[model samples]
Target: MYKPQLNMESLERCVKSLEENENNVRDEAQKALLNICRNVLRSPNDDKTREVRLDDEVVVEKLLPAIGAMECLFDVGYVEDGERLFLPGNVSLSRLQSLSKLLSAVSESKPVTKDIEENSTAQKAFFKKISKDFHNVMHYEDPDLQKKARSVIPIAQLEIAAMTKMRHLQKSYKFSDARKTTSSTQFETELTAKDLLLVELLHWFKHEFFEWVNSPKCSRCSTECVYESVVPSTNHRCSRIELHRCEKCNIIVEFPRYSHPEPLLTLRRGRCGEWANVFTLLCRSLGYDARFIYDETDHVWTEIWSASSKKWIHLDPCENVIDKPLMYEKGWKKKLTYVIAYSKDEVQDVTWRYTQDQEAIMKRRKICTEESLIQFLRSLTDQRQNSSNYSSARKNYVIMRSLLELADMLYIPNLQNKNSNEIYEGRTSGSLAWRLARGEIVQADIEKNYIWDVSKYGKMFELRYNIVKDIYHVVHNDGTILEQKSGWQEGTNITNGGIFRKVENDWKMVYLTRSPQAQYGCIKWIFEIANSELYLETFKLRTKSEVFHGARVSWKIEAIFSDDKVIVIPVSNCNNFYTEDVRKAVKLNIIVTLSGGQGQTAWQHAQVFRQSLENIEEASMIINIQLKNH
Candidate 1:
């Protein structure tokens, strides 16, 4: 009799080694096991049934020991009855999920016995049931979407590569810090210079490549024309052309409504649809991840992925607006029904991002059942995944990650429980920044006077002020009296008098003041008076400060006062003054410190104030200031 020696400890060592060195060592170990099974052992009986039984016994006795030995080394607990192994903490969540699913699948495949024929029948039935359920949920029948998705595949690859290179190039340029707070700030933050290369390309295409097609001009007389009637497309290849007649020349002009992006690239202009289609295609061409965001209120835009931020930022090529998500709803005051974002890999209902009142917006959603919409999106996602060149595992990972991201966006907390009327009123109230920009003087009635304890940017400060004989007796939050000079009119002196006006049921005190030198500029202070408490919402200042090289410096300062106080802390020996060509430039270096009430420092920034004494003149600069309490 010949017997095979099974070294469980040696098998365990080899299995543990596979974790560190998987390829070569694992292959060798597998081969050695196979060779041992084939050459070392022999069947005891000559009967085929007995030989098969002996083979099964040999496999179970030899291989099962190795598996059991691995349990100790891997720290995995195995249950014999259920054939379930408790995975170690080191295993990933996805890996654990996959293993659990595999175990369930294997159990279902062999419900009664481990017979191969029965297992195969069970597997087929399971798959058939899954296929039926999938079809029932995903009943979308849009061939055009499928065709478009397939067409963009090659375009996406090339564009992604180009955008990657552009991002690298953009890293080399330095932008000014002053531009960070402007309207373009959101765009700049979302898309840096590197990101804007793609935007610039799109902008160029919009201006040079695309033409704005309105009414056609008369060919004979070169006169402006109006559309007389629409001539429908005769075939699929040709678009519907409009028959236009020139009012001045009495000449007819034919205008083709080019709907496709491929032809529109050459034909050049249609409307919002044509522009969005071509722009989206162009974005895809640069390898940039993009989506066509269709607003049901007859508008369309594109959103490109910002790799740096890991988010899709809004980009409107037609308006040259980037990352202005609130432009339509807040800026344009458009009531949106639905804002569906469609990408090659997925579809998302992103209406919440745009609309302030979700309840009002939901009332207008009458297109399809939510269930059917989800099914359509799932179908599109499936088609895209099928068309994707990535492996099954990679595609599945991407799909899962995307769904998680969408879920996160959909469940964000709604802080403002504002109704339709409140939303409208809030918008009309015009923020501190808006009123300051317009340099508007607003007045309100002061109901009563009381000292207000305020904090600006976490720095504690108390305002002591009262209205006496229609004149505001104002004092600084630090108990310092503001300078009220001779020949100063009430409400016109920045440090002294102010007028109040009613705004949104709150009294707004509009105070005017000038800098230490009127040549520097004038500052307007608007304080909101509510509950006998004064709240500084905002301040606007227009100042002409002297800089170096005889260059006059003009500054427009709009400061929004919050709960946190802005404290100017002077720094010793940091100030540097230099003269260039007899023009002195004073650079006042100080640390802008911010602290909370608990005596803890919140934030600090080093600020350098530069001024030139070359063209020192009374600039008549107007600064409007407004304050907001939150």
Candidate 2:
């Protein structure tokens, strides 16, 4: 005769209490025992009665022996009788699974059962209650969840969209996988630029931005410690603190579990909460509209908006995963009931996106009614949208569009029947063409022509002397032209020129050649007497302005001579002279001087002068000096 030592009703009640309880210690113990039972019964055999018998035998013979293995694996205690197992109110999922595996390995014998159908009803009801409680626990809402979500989502979006350091990161970490993967073969045949950018950003956030916190050494002995316990935080700065006991010296240390993202950024270390929070912030810093996803099963991650694909892509910073929503339920074998995502403009129930067993998930969602949940989310969304600075029509349109998107996700027939492109057009104009029309979100402004007031810097005018075959021509901005014999003669004067000034938005030339001392004869050299002080001042101002506007400015001097000869050179100084000695040494050598902001000055001489400026009939030859900003 076999009698159960553990009352199934008591265990079932404990599992049910797990859903309503807030105490961490009691909940952990219940979760551990329930997980062990789930793993033990999760065998491939479908014989319900045989499984029940095997489960009982396993609990008595194999499971009790496996408790020793769990004791070694984790800092937890357990008590067991013939059929019931009691835990020391502290257990982690990892150690639970480890114990369950050990039990399964030891209890390999098949159980014989004759009354399979008779026991099926009771077994089903017991398991059903356990499943319901487990689901309720998974969806249990944290008081601060909504607040954290709101703080993180919009900022994450801004971070990823505006990130300028991406190119450097891309060079170091190639996004080969991003370019290869398509969102869906049926709809999105190719990866768009936004898609690729999102993937790259995920990689950057995971590999470059965040790092895990290593366990601290023992304070007394300086030896590595094993994590032992956790105390839930009473205040807002942190969520909890973990206890680590040294293996060598029996010394205990406390490790604070942080919840804030700002401090975590500087500390650069933490578990999933810190990782997700900081990652969300980084995503927003780059200007990619993002959402902070809160998994009810004690995890968090990010989701970013893809304008090109017109969807939100899942990104797990800790796992370096992108667009794999089913990883939690399918890969991790997690039974999730709620996956809420929060953004600045909306609160969404995104659970369906991550889970495969929607029916089971819905059954466990007993905390709130569907209508109430929808109303709460809608109210939150409305509060956010109404608080925004957007115009009425734009706000309505955005809200309507968002609701349609939510409908599409929920498979509400009306909106889901329409193409995604149509929904996008409802928010924008017709078609998804507006995103393409907007162009790149973060592009550098192209440099354009800038007008510099010469009066503010130096003299607004200059003079030039050119020699054509048997022609000595001197030109000035004052509309004065002087011609002398081609050869230098005795008593010849060569000081005549013109001075130009900018007045009333026009260049007014004053003739200096009217005086006898300003007259010149047969001189074939160019001389410039610029104000060095003004040149330096103007250069500094120009460079400073360019830098302030995120640009660079450069100066060049070009000299045109008679007989269609032209010489161009770079300028870098306040005083420059084109002497005849150098001109003869290097035929057509022209001196160019430039002085501008930030102590930048350049002087260059160009020897090539094949192009001639003699085709012009005007007496004064034009010397074009160009200032370019880049």
Candidate 3:
């Protein structure tokens, strides 16, 4: 297990800095962010509401320019998707709503009160306890642990140059067999050319480049060896040595479990750890950005960044597996928690990418609080991104790649490639008993036992209330009898709906007839802002001073279902009425369930449009919205 080696105080400082950036752009950024978050919290299941157009002038000018704002967004689960920012459905809506409330207060210039200060202090203490718990784990404080963890890639990079000199490996019979039998046709057809090349390399590496060593064979007698006792290793490459005895020859054999990749290149025989280490080095030697993924449950693998695919693809050299992220969890039924991927330029928590049961995994995550764990991981990544060893271009590339991987972990669906022959076969490299004892063998009907909660996975989202403060009641009043209404269709049944459009510096209302098959009418007002930021300062039905006829107006927020059905959102105070932002649009659709010359109509309705807004005597609403340069 890779324990987090981080200073809790430094982490606290980092978080405070992330939150305390006082850049002037922070205000507008938070306002824009608040709107975006409100929409997501309102209609979490609605995919359109979760996207932030990255290319839009508003996002480019207001959100992206503010680093603090972008950090806040990322913290709340917004990730990049090409030209847009997406909040994945896997994110907890309740958590997001809470964070948004804090952000809203920040945007409105509300000072943190004493209670809030006390709460923050308690949160810091909790995080400190988490950090302390991490240190309590055995070997967590071992100076060599973190050093070895960070040194894997740099050492692997150096091995790339030494690989050419490994004459013993080149001369081996296994190498010849691998070279002779290598075939690209065995791989999936959908693989890009670059991916195909990696597949070929993996095929060669698994079959010939490396060998799994359960126990050392007798050098004097060609016989299988049995594990004896552990012994200290004199070799610098291995921290510990295993003593084995030949069954037939009664001879002792020494098996050193090498930690470094240099000796593995020549020896070519070890367990998953050595195989992963060497294979990852080979990948880097071939000019691919590769990572060593360490699963806390005692397994190791390699992840290669495919430029063609633009994402990290899982590879298990020991099993000759390609892209079977869920095989361990689903096929072998391993209870996984932490699976961290480390490279020269990044450190990522990739546990989400491999599990089908996140709820279960989350329960098993007892090592630290999620917030502290994420902050620890981010701190590691920030160090790499701003490393003095990297060039400006390289730093930028690392930053971009980190963002891309973040998006993949949060947003991309982990649909394993079906073409992998061994996806469900489970451990093939080790002996049958070893596989069974380690619970690496795929059991009959094991996968069937793990049923995924659709609502908790994929593109699903939780239905939540809108963050709006209040919903003003619609009041009606009687007015003078209508003479002739402009833009009213005489033959049309105009009692149902009306469209509000800005025309010639004044807003015009066009009466729309309710479809004969429809139940009620809707009064819709759409405000579209192109390449600019928009904010709803106020949306209220103002009271009128004049006396008039009265009509009953019931205001109900409605949501469009996937089946195109309009279902009333049963929330009080207009908090259920979520504003939709689609392609730089803010639409307000008010559905009027009842209308007409029923004795219930009024004159004061002119202040706030009546149920029958089509009546020429009715007044319009004062929509106070601000659309300005981002």
| lDDT of each candidate versus the true structure | 0.41, 0.42, 0.51
Superposition error at 302 for model 1 (Å)? 1.1
lDDT of 1 by residue, 1-630 (tens): 001112332223223323333344434433334333232123212223111111122322333223222222122111110111122222223322222333333335532223223224323332343343233222122345334533534435445655776556444333656454544545456556447466556656555566555455578766556545555687543456656677766777787765455566556676566677777776665556777777755467888877667667787766666766666765555556667776655666677766666775665444345565566566756776787474788588666657655764564325223332331211222222222211122222222222222233222222222221123323454545443222112333132111122111011112222211012222132232232233443322232222332222222222222333333222222222211211111111111111111111001011112222222321222222233443
| Candidate 3 lDDT | 0.51
Better of 2 and 3 by TM-score: 3
Report the lDDT of model 2 for residue 43: 40
lDDT of 3 by residue, 1-630 (tens): 111122233222222333433566766676777787788877878988987654344565565444345545555556543234566665666546755776666657775222223234435554454343223222222345444433433444334434533334345634566656644333222344456556656776777657777666679865557655555588766766766677677888887877766666668788788888777766765567887887866588989887666788999988888877887886766778778777766667899888767887786554456776788767756765676766889888877887787788775343443333444666777653335334455322111121111112112111111111112111212322222223322211223332121111011222222221122344322222222243222233221111124332345433333245554433233312333321122332333332322221211122223223233333433222222232
> Where does candidate 2 stray beyond 4 Å?
1-14, 17-194, 213-224, 232-235, 388-394, 410-630
Worst 10 residues of 1 by lDDT: 598-607
Model 1 per-residue lDDT at 118: 23
Better of 1 and 3 by lDDT: 3
Every model's Cα RMSD, please? 30.1, 28.4, 28.1
Q: Rank the candidates by TM-score, best first.
A: 3, 2, 1
Per lDDT, the best of the predicted structures is 3
What is the full ranking by lDDT, best candidate first?
3, 2, 1
